[model samples]
Target: DQQVKQNSPSLSVQEGRISILNCDYTNSMFDYFLWYKKYPAEGPTFLISISSIKDKNEDGRFTVFLNKSAKHLSLHIVPSQPGDSAVYFCAASHGGYQKVTFGTGTKLQVIP
Candidate 1:
């Protein structure tokens, strides 16, 4: 069973548009969260992360917002580019990264 879930399996956005990827979790104890982007054969690469203590975190064109009450989080990519197309995974863990749970993942396609 999966503790984290990404409702949408795929999303398509035009180049230079804003792309939003959403995720929800069943556990409330998860304090640390992370987002990863994966290409075809390679392992997932870290995108952004947020702690439960903070509602939001940002880096460059990437931003992650956490809503503890709703057990939901979202990753927003501004000016989405063709190179940004990949499968994104939402992950969470508690107790200082001892263990992590990942969502099924959402494939994002940025059309040029």
Candidate 2:
């Protein structure tokens, strides 16, 4: 069973607008969460991450939030740029295990 799911396969937003991607999980044992950004034909780059101990984490233009009670997480990008157009994957891990189960992918298209 897929532990994590991103309902929307893709999202399109204009430059200077906000982009939000949502994900849900069924595993309650997951304590560490991560988000990765990927470009075409390239490997995913670590973007932001949060631990189950905290509710939110932010770095520069990217922010991620985790709600343990709901087994949900989200990523927010403000003032999205054309370069931000890429796939975003949400992942989770536990017990020092780094095997991250990725979502199908969320293709964020930032229009200029």
Task: Please write out the lDDT profile of model 1 over residues 1-112, one tens digit for every residue.
Answer: 7899999999999999999999999988899999999999999999999999999999999999999999999999998999999999999999774778999999999999
Q: How many clashes in each structure?
A: 0, 0
lDDT of each: 0.96, 0.92
How far off is residue 27 in model 1, in Å? 0.6
Measured against the true structure, the TM-scores of the candidates, in listed sequence, are 0.98, 0.96
Q: Which residue ranges in model 2 land beyond 4 Å of their true spot?
A: none
Residue pairs with clashing backbones, model 2:
none
